[model samples]
Structure formats: C-alpha cells, structure tokens
Target: MKRSDGLKMKLVDTYTMERVVAGSASRYPKRIALRTYAEEGSELTYSELKRKSDAVSLYFLEQGFVKGDRIALIGESCPNWMLAYFGLTGIGLTAVPVLPEFSPKEILHILQDGGVKAVVVNARHVEKILPFIRKKPEFLIRLEDLFHIPMPISGELKDRNQFLNAPGRDITRRKVDAKARQLLSEHRPKEEDPASLIYTSGTTGMSKAVMLTHRNLVWNADISSDVYFKVKPGYKALSILPVSHVYEFTIGQVLALLCGCEIVYLGRPPAPSSLLPALKEVRPHIIMTVPLLIEKIYRSSVLPTLKANPKLQRYLRFGITRRFIFRIIGRKLIVTMGGRVRFFGIGGAPLDREVEAFLAEAKFPYALGYGLTETSPLISGGKPKNHTVGVIGKIVEHLEVRLEEKDPATGIGEIAVKGPSVMQGYWNNPALNEEAFTPDGFFKTGDLGFIDKKGRLAIKGRTKTMILGSGGENIYPELIEAVINNQDFVTESLVIPEGGALVALIKLDIEAFAEKMALSVNEAKSEAARYLNKLREEVNKELNVFSRLSKVHLQEDAFERTPTQKIKRFLYLRKKDESSDA
Candidate 1:
C-alpha cells in the first residue's frame, strides 16, 4: 500500500494529539462542537457545550473539589453529560463515567470502587439510588447542580424547577471552572496522570476499574484515526455507542470532539426504523457500531431478500445486481442509510460471517477492530479485504506487537503490545497488574492472534476463556459459535461448555424461518428448532473431539448484552453442568 495523493499524515506522538484537541477547542470554540438528541429531537450545539462545560468546571471549583478527585458522570447519553466530562478532565480531575443501564447495586459498587468524591448524575436516575443518597450527601450531587445557575428564581418556574430542587440550584456551591482553567494554565496534567477510571463491563467478574491517562486515550485515538480513517473537522458522525465504554469514549466522544465532528447522539439505542429515519435526518458520514448490530442489520434486513432468490444473491456476490428486483433492494438500503455513510466501524464482538458477506455485497464500509480496556481498546483496526480476513488491522505506529511463542505453528499466539496507550495498570491492584504485563513492559492483551503474512492481526479468542480438554488441548468457544451462527436458521449462538462437553445456546430467527416453511409462528418454531438441531449436528461433526457439543439449547430470547453489545458470558458460566472434569 502506497500513498496516492499529497494527503499523507505523519504519525503524530501522543503529546501532539492532546495539544491538538485542546487547541482545536480554542480555535473552533463556536463550531457545532457536539449535538445531543433529546426529547422530540431537541439538540444542543458547540457554543452551548462550551458554556455549560465552563460553568460546570467553575461549579466544581466552587464546591471545593480538588484535583485528581474522581467525579462520576452517571447517566444515559446527553449534552450535559459530555459537558461534565470535559469540565472534570479539562481541569486535571479524573472522570468516572458510568452507564445509566447499570443496576443500582452495580452503580454503587463502581462509584465506591473508584472512590468517587463528586457525582454529577442524571436526575431521572437519582431515585434509583435515592435511599443511599443521605449516607453520602456530601458526594451525591445531581447534574443540574454542577453548572453555575442563577439564584433559585423564587417565583413560578416550571421548566427550571428541576434545577432548583434537591441537590440542585446551589448558586453559591462554588464557581470553579474559571479557577480550574487558571490552575490548568499553571499546572497542567502530564500525559501519564490518571485522567479517567473506566470500569470494564464485568461480564466475567467484578468490573475492574481500568485507569487510563490522557496519553493513553489521545494516543490510541490518533492511531485509530490514522489507520482506520483520518477524521477531519466537521466530519458528520453518528454516536449510538455508549460513552461509558472505552471504544465509544475514545472513538465516539473524544475522537469525534478532537476531529470537530458534530455527533448526532441518538438518545436511545437505534432501532431500524428510528435509525433509518435519523440517518436521513442527520445525514451522517461516519457511524461507530458493534459487530452484533451490523450483523443483525445484514441478517434481518439484507440477507433474507437475497436468500429468497439464489440468482439475486449470486448477482450480489459480484457487487452488481442483475435484476431490477435486486437493484431495488440494494437501493432501498442505501437510500434508507442516507446514501452517505462512508465508514461504518464495527467492534466490541465478532461478526457473523454471513452478515459480513451481505454487508460486503451491499458495499458497506464495515471495518472491524480488536483490543481490550488495557490498550485503550484499540490494538488494530482498518478496512476489510480478503488478505485481512478477520484480521483487526495493521499495528498502529509506535505500537510494538509480537507473538509470545515464535516457532512452527499456525502463526497465532498471545498478542503483547508495548506502547504509551497501554494502561498504567489496574488501579490499586499491583498483583493483577504484575501478571497483566510482560517482563519487558509489553502489556498482555489476553487475545490470541496471529500476524498474517500481510501483517494484519487475526484474533483467535481470549486466553482465559479458551476451553481446556482432558488431553490438555485448547478449544475456542468463539470458533464453535462461528460455525453455529453461520447456519441459516440461527440468529445468534454462544458455545457454553456443559458437563465436559460443549453446548451451543442458540437464538433463532423464528419469523423468517416460519415464513420460509410456510407455516404459522407456533408451528414454525418447532420446525425451525428441528432443522436447527440438524444444522448444529452437521457443524459439530466437523469440530475436534474435545470441542464437540453434547447438546444444543434453542433459546427464544436474545443473550443479555453489555452496553457495547457483547454477550454477558459470566451469566452463562453457572448454567454449565457442574459434573464436568477439571
């Protein structure tokens, strides 16, 4: 691959990327910095963003919040949420972002786990933990109270009453944004100083607070931008990803802000109808999505029509539709998506192959990435091609990646990364941190990947989650799920080991299968399950002896997913039979 035009960008150091974001804020302060889609399509622009963030920082200073204090911004997506985050970190304090979907117990655990001193939580979610607020009144503060507001207008104030009530409208609370900025001008944060304490979704165990510094976030974004798509100012972006996750924060919020993109934040998780309409309304050029979403879109929306007509799918395989029927289907999707989505970046989980092919046929720019919280969630990412099949992408500049075992093999092994984007290590868990990193400093990614001859990284599975066998062989559940999910009737599949044997808990597309069978909904499920069982048996025959499934559980409900759309694996660990061998 060679540069074609005069558009080559030098691989920037982490320091420069941070300077660029802050500097860009100053240079383009009045630009449409961010847009928060609220009730009935309400939005807030860049100037409003700057003003609110400034006021919040001032309020923090007024409240006597010291530097390094972890200010938890707990809420669903909103403009004020972003304001509080920037205000906290812009002044050298750590931002602890919590997803609003978290259980009250989980929220309390993280808020306490991070030792959050100040909380700027959404009012809507306040009552969920209202009972516990009195115990920590000093730290429990609502979002509306954080920004400097006018003295509680004593008269009839309806829309403003929400701000004037409990944990709100404290005009004298402390106007600190100006003071914090002044302090920032005097003593700024080094790249290494902890800036955010993001907790992993904890699908496996108690969520670990992954400490990321300014350097890590900024550097990782820079690499992702350069390698994936060099985002420019005013780049239209759709941000459906939750800001609490590392991928969404770095790529969706921080990166979008750094690039000066006007993100169309959907207040809710995007449904096809709502998403298509919003796409037409926003006309965004970029979209950050999880693999599961992309796969679903292709399977439920695109693949059915293709499979109905084998001749049409064959034509689609060539990137050209022969019949008018085929063209109509293709054009419908393109037009529905606003006909301008150039980069549909996918991550957070593995995509089903059939869905991937459908997207490719429809000419979707569905790039994939692979990484974990420790590396700021970006180890490799890029455009997909044949040689890059299932490979994340070329290693970003300044990242040194090597396989732990370098002998005759499938060219796959644990991926260890050495870079500034690597975390300073888990907070207050030196024992875990010591085990997480290599002796020479390369952080263990826990992913097994092989660098292809073309230099792209292809992931096998997590080191911890890889199933062990009686003969001491390793089997990846993801590999088994890949085959199970590829079957036409299957919608999603999870390979769970039960009683010393693998079992695939599968969700089926009942309606589609029912229609195909020309049967009613009730009859279709029974027919689909029988057919799916046969499909599973066929797939199982190809697996290694240890990786074989003893049974197949047909699930009508979808697997519980994290905010980022990853299946909650820990929830299924107990469902496995306890009689299995060690």
Candidate 2:
C-alpha cells in the first residue's frame, strides 16, 4: 500500500535496530542527537551516541550476554537509558522498559514475567527493586556509572612496549574496529525478533506485557515519519511523556532518531513551573503531549480569563471576531510554549472539545492522535493543518481499520485494526491473545466510534464505559462529563450509573470557588450543597435528556488515575456502586 504522499509502504523483512543506529550515525555523525534537561545536562552527537552504545554492547558481550537474553531498563528518561536500550537491542537482547512510576510490586512482576537477566537502573530506582536482588539476574548496573565511564580509545594498549610499537598501530586499530563491527553484525536481530516487552499502562485493567518485534516498531516509525510527522533532520522535539510508554518510545524517541531530530528530555515531570523554563530554553519545534496537560492549561489559563471577560466571551460566539481575538492571545500562548512549536501532538486520550475548538480558533498548531499500546501506539493522526476539531484524523498508511458490529442507526462500533505495527500478542498469555483478536486477525481496540462522512474518526466513548439509560438509550458518560467539567468551579468529573439513575461524581476546584465567592473554606463547605444543586442544574441544560445526571456528589479527593492521568474509571465505578448500596 502506498501512502497519500505516493510513498509505498514496504515492510523490511530483515531490518534490525543495529542497522538503525548505524545508519543514523553514518548519515548525521555531527548532528546533535539528544539533549537532557538535568542539572548537569548534556547533549550527544550521533557519533558520540553510537560510540557509547557500542561500548555498552561490548561490555555486555564481555559479560557473556548473548542473543535473546532479556534486560530490564528502569529509570526516568535520560541519555544513559537510551544508550542502554540501543546497546541491548543492537546485540539482539530483548529490552524490557519498566515504567519508573510503577510500584515496587509492579516492577517485580514485570521483571519476573520477563525473566530479566540483567537490569540497568537509575540510583533512585535501586531501592525499589532491592527485594528482587536476591533472586539474582546476572548484573545490576547503575545508569549514572555508565554515563561517567568513558569508552577505551585504543582497546586498552597493554604496556609501554605495545605503545612504542606504533608502526602497525593504525592497522591494528582498523582491525579492532572491523572486529567489533563484525561481532555486532553477527548478533543483529531479525525483524521478527522481539525487540521490546512493553507492559500496558492499564487504564482499563491489569497490565499485560505486550511483545513488539523489531518490525512492529521500525515499520510504525517509518510510516509515521512518512505520513503523520514529516519531521526533517535537525528538527527539535521536546519529549515530556514517559519513555516507557510505547507512544513516547516509538514516536518521541525512535521516530526522532529515524529523522535525525534532536530530542530534549525534560528531567523533571512537566508540571507547569518546571516545563515553562525548559520550553523557553529548548525552544522545541514539536511537542508530543497527552490531553490532560493541554486541557489543564486551557482550564486554568484560557478558560478562566475568557469567562471573566464578558466582551471577549461574547466575541467568541462569532467566528471572525473569535479568530481575531484569539490570534492575539494565541501569540502569547506560543511565546509561553517556547515560541517555536510548529506541531503540538496530543494523544493518550480524547481531547476535550472546548479546548480543541479554542486551539482551532486561535490557529494553534495542535494535532489530535488516536491509538493504543497494542498498535505500537499510533493508529491514526494528521498534521495540525489538517486537524478537525473532535476528529482523530484519517487512518494511517499500511493499516486497515474498521468499525465492527455497528449499530444500524448511529453507525457506531468497536474500532478494530490490522497492521504490521500490531503486537505479536500478549506475552505468555494465550487466553488474552485469543480474546484480543478477531478470528480473521484484527486486534479489537475496545473503543467505540464512527467514521464521519469525511472519513475522519470521532470517538463516542470507551465500550467499557458506556452506560445504558433507564429508557434503554446509550449514554456516553464522557460526553456528559465533558459538559460537567466545563462548568464553573469544577476541576474534573466522572458520571456513572447507579440504581438505574445517572450519578455524577465531581471534584470541585474548592480554592478557586471559595476565592470567587469571597468565602472562607468553612463557609464554602457550608454552602456547597446549594451551590452543587445549581451547578447540576446548569450542567443538565448542556446535556441530552438521556445523559442528564439524576444526582451530583462532591468527591472529597481527586479520583485515582493511571500514569497518563486518565481517571481509573473502574476504581470509581466500584466506589460508586458501594456508596449506592450504603
């Protein structure tokens, strides 16, 4: 299949990670490959990166590690982490990237499941995995130590006599280099070989290790670069998403490397305070983020300001006036976002419609993407210029996507996909493998949506989250929650069914509400009942009849969420049921 750009999708049957690193180094040796945002942050050129990775590979080989050996990499995103990944995978070993945010138990489960033989970890993560040390894998090396140790320049000249015998030194050096290259080539993994064992973030259920082969990752990177990204060599990308997540691993790291782009990894979590300075310093050309971060910026920075200004709010009702006004505001937003971002890729979850509309009006370069870890994380996405609000743009090249088991009237169905990027299957879990795929081989995505007349996909909700109304109508809680979340003083919300009645669990912005009302916390709490009643009535006005909330409950704490900041709906649903019975 050829992409819309006329580039044919050719799956390489024998492509390997070793070739990828070597090709990049050969093509752009002097190019800045990666920059980190740590206190003593540094940048690495392609040549340096290739050399360090080779050194690490040689070290592993010296330790008797060979093909198919599993190595665990657990740490925050850093240059050493990438080197370790490249080194291990270049020598045909499986790299298991454990999320740094995982609890000790979660980490142990993954290490055990993969039978990880060695681990490369940051100092911060050592204590967490100490319990597993006794059940020893071959080695446990610290990432910082690897970064400080330099690779040998001349393969360790033994004594002064060997040093003085310099007539044949140049030939010896060439021979040593050739031998190292040969060793790497001998162990190079095939396209079908498992390159990574990535565990899902488990927003819906327990985490499962997803086995992605070299072909699955490389092909996805090729297609993404050709179709969705169009990133040029020397382009700069700010990477804030966790590297362990397949979304970031492939698009943020692999695709960046493939295009010879310089990636800047934020040392700290991308909280606004830290992120603002990093953005200014890096001035990245592109950014890959989840909806939660952008939505928070919209709610905290954009929404409140607009709501406070009546004239601006009224102007927003008209297209021309809104665009003109937002243009000025958007310029400021661009400056705040490093002043050079050509593309802001939003994924992980569906973006809020209000936020998307604002970005469109402001002419912000933000694109919506849709996919899951099972599909190497990108099933569909488009450039900012082609973005349609509420639509997850066209299907990506080389993939077949369909809406299965559609309703005759609404045309909604589960989004199923078949492509090379899809995983081999859940690791060692035959039951899940059988349940995950249809008989014909499409991987069931478990999302509910319909393709519009223009062929753009719009998600209604997750199939697991859809509620049945009392009158047997389908109610998408996400749609209702979006409305509720847009209301004044609401931070976030979750809508669930209870005793045949729709209930909303809301976490209010208490501090903001109290400040707005000019009341103390005690006073705000005292009057919350009356305020919540009015808030519920206001939200109902924006929702459909079937999706209206029967009652609203104020949640004292924020809802438990996954690593991606998606609310753990299962946890809240269980709690809601328990409360209803109480």
Candidate 3:
C-alpha cells in the first residue's frame, strides 16, 4: 500500500484471501505485517508472509490434499498460525480455527465433526488431541516453523514434545518445481467458497461449526473499515482477544491487513504486568478486546479511586464537574494505555452501564459493538466518537436488519439479519440450518433487541434466557445481573428463576472485603452472607418490581464462562435437586 498519507486506496475486486494476500504483497511487500509484542525476532513482512503461506499451500497440494478439504488450526495467536490459515484458505482448503482453551473432549469433538484431514498445531496444544489418536488425523504439522510432525514411534502416543521435536519433513525445505509454481500462480478460489469453518463457544452448552465463506469474511472486513475509525499505513493494532473468535479474526486481523496496519500479538495473556508494558512499547493506534477486560480495569482501578476521595465523591454528584473530573482521569488512562490509542473496540458481550457511562463522560475512546459468530460477527458498530452510550451503532452498509415479532409495549424482539457477511449455514446440520433462518432467508440471531428512533441497535437479552413473570411480563436476567454486578463488593453475579421467583447468585470481592474489614476468609464469608440481603435490596431498587430479586445467595465458586467471558446460563439453570445453594 502507498503511504496513505494523502493518497486514495484503490478497492480490490475479488473478496478472497488470495486476492487480499496478493494485493498486500504487491503494494507493500516490505511493510511489517505481523509480530509478537515481547519477542525480538518474530516479525513477518507482507512479502515474507505471502511466500511462507504459498510454500505451505504448495506442500499441501503436493501431499494430495485437494480443494474443499478441512484442516484444523490449533494454537495461540501467532504469525505462524496466520500463515497456516492463509495457506489453507488461499489454496481453496477450509481452515477450521479451534480455540486453544477447549478441553480434550471438545477438541476431539471439533476434529471429528469438522472432518479434519490434517492438524496444524503448536506444541502447547498437542496434549488436547492426544487422547483420541485413533479418530484423529494422521498428518500433523507443527505450527512453530511449518514442519511436518510425524506420528509417534510404534503408532503410540508417548510425549508431545517428542512429536514436536521429531520433525519428519520441513514444508519450506523442498524446492518449488516449475509445474507446482505455475499451478499455484494460476489457482484462484471463487468468492463463495468456504474459507473458514468456525465452531462457536456456545453459552447454551451446545456447539456448532459456522461455515463462513470468502465473501462473508472479506466483505465484512471491508465494510467494517468504513464503520470504525480510519487508519493509515504502518498504524499499530494490539490484538488481545482470541483469534479463533470471529470478533477478533475479522476486526483485528483482516481489517488491519486491509488497512496496511501492523498487528502486534501478546506473548501471553494480557494481565496488567505484561499488558501495561506492551501498551507502552507498541503504543497501538487500535485495540480489540471484550468488555470484561475494560470492566475489570474500571472496577478495580478507576471506581475505587473516585469513591475513596471525599471531595471528589461529593463533586461527582454534579454532572458538569463530574465529567470534567472523569476527563482528567481518562487522560491518565490513555497514557497508561500507551497514549496513542484511537479506536478501542469492545464486543463479544454487553458492557456494564456504569463502565459505559464513565467511558462516555471521561472522553475515553471506547466503541461498543453487537454481533454473533453467525453474521461474520459485526452487525452493528461505529467509531468511538460516534457511539451512543446505551446503543450499539447503526447496522453496517448492505445489510438488512429488523426486529422479529416485536412487542408493542417494549418494542423488543428477536434480531434477524440478512447480508453478504452472513455465514452459509451450520456445517452438516440440516435440522439446525432449517431452524436458524426464516422462510424469507433472514438468519434469526436468537437475541432480543430493537432499533432505536436514532437508528441505533440496543440489545435486550437472549430469547432462551428470558424468563416469564407470573403476570406474563418478560424478565431479562442479564439486565438484573447488570444491576447486581455494579453493586459495591460484588465481583460478578448470575440471576436465575427458581420456583417462579428470580434468585441471584452473587460472587463477592472476598479480597477487598477481607482487606477493608481486617477479617479472615471465614469471617469474610460470614460478613458477605450478612450483606447479601442489603445488596439485593440495593439492586432491586434499580430494577422493575417484577424483575426484583427474591433471594440472594453467596456463590462460593466462580461461574463458568465462554471464551467471550459470558456466563454459561445453561450450566447454572440446574434442577431443584442439584442446587448447590449456600
């Protein structure tokens, strides 16, 4: 890409990975495409990335893998992982990106369901697939350097590292023959071809592989560029979310490539110690993360400081002064986050109202987005400066979105969408495919929401999770939980229906409670139990009468969550006999 300082970028015709790679390589071959935040020599230029991916593609073709074959990609987010993904997709093979956090059983299920003929994985995740050797693929390639890892000696699983170190053939080592080079140069996949088969992290405790075509992925990335803030060549983007999630893959990776931006990946999880230093080092112009990350920062750091100061707490009662004070703190936060961030995209789950209010008042550049794995992940979003506090931005261009079976009183209903970015269907599941879309071909999002008068989308809750009140009113557990979560000393909360009444399972900030009260763990637990009723009363005051909590219990264990940090509601909706109530 040209410097993009004052030049206009010509749009590409095809919406395939091959076209994206070729265009970038031809325009900005020397531009740094990908790198690690902490590592020294882990950078790949656009030219190098294209060359490496092409070599992997040639190797697979030589191995007799034809078009439409499924290949599983399992590893942490790294350049090599992208290389393998691009290689597979560029050669017309479907790339199934699996999350590294999946259990052994989950990984095996995905491998079996995806019909993966081969697996490209790093050594870190090799153990997840070791138990199901009989049903797993025979061809294994190490993701670190694109070397083929042969099966273990005696066809038995011994050590994962032995398989990692004992490389049989290096894919890049073989010379490219004339015919192979010609074939690779001539090969082109159609825009409608399936580029990625993504298995969603189901919060409902069921998984399905969502097949996203080349057009779905690329077109979404292209349109999203117009939705978010503008970026020039060489702009830095720090990626913290799991790339296996469509939210990160399309917005963080593909969108950066389209803009000629350099993507920096964290070497480890984005904990404070590591992420703070990386923020200072990279000084990223863009960041993609889920709401939990920012909500933690606000709850742990920002909220306490404001409340602890007596004069500031008094001043916070006034609107004008409070916003000024928040802006000052927001400037400090910007400095803490490398002082150069322009677009901070938050998605995957609903952001807390308190945190969102603070962000808007503080002038923090935070954009809220709403989507799912089925719609190529971006149904509505906007630039931070253009974002409304309680609403996700307008639907992207070229998409038709409407509320289905909207309530006359509340105006909330299931969000149905139809667009080029929508996925083809659930892979190999005819029953689900039939139920997922309407007769007119609109994909039912399973979410309850409505379009505002200002043309923005506001999400209410999921259809399955909505509880019916005794008087036939709708009670959204998420809205009640949001109130509970914003309470003092509350870390997280879950609201469920028990015996026709809403009950809240609350997890307290034990360490904070212990520190403040100078109490031991047992004493803190007792103290928290005593405070639950008061906490329930406080939360109920912010909610409607029907949505009020009937009981509040101290949950000792943390609730299980999906990759996006959404509490798995199905896991907690237990039988009355199976209740672990405290």
| Candidate 3: C-alpha lDDT | 0.86
- Between candidates 2 and 3, the one scoring higher on lDDT is 3
How badly does each model clash, as a count of residue pairs?
A: 5, 0, 2
Model 2, 454-558: lDDT tens digits are 777888898888888778888898999989888888888888888888888888888888898899987887677788889999998888888888899888798
Considering every candidate listed, which one attains the maximal TM-score? 3
Q: Determine which window of 10 residues in candidate 1 has minimal summed lDDT.
A: 151-160
Q: Quote each prediction's TM-score.
A: 0.87, 0.91, 0.96
CA lDDT, candidate 3, residue 533: 92
What are the runs in model 2 whose C-alpha is more than 4 Å off?
1-14, 38-41, 147-176, 579-582
Better candidate number, 1 or 2, judged by TM-score: 2
Q: Is candidate 1 or candidate 3 better by lDDT?
A: 3
Across residues 482-571, which tens digit of lDDT does each residue of candidate 1 receive? 888777878787887665777788888888778878999999877766786788779978787788887887788888888777778877
Evaluate residue 115 in candidate 2 and report its C-alpha lDDT on the 0 to 100 scale: 88
TM-score of decoy 1 = 0.87
Residue 32 of model 3, lDDT score: 98
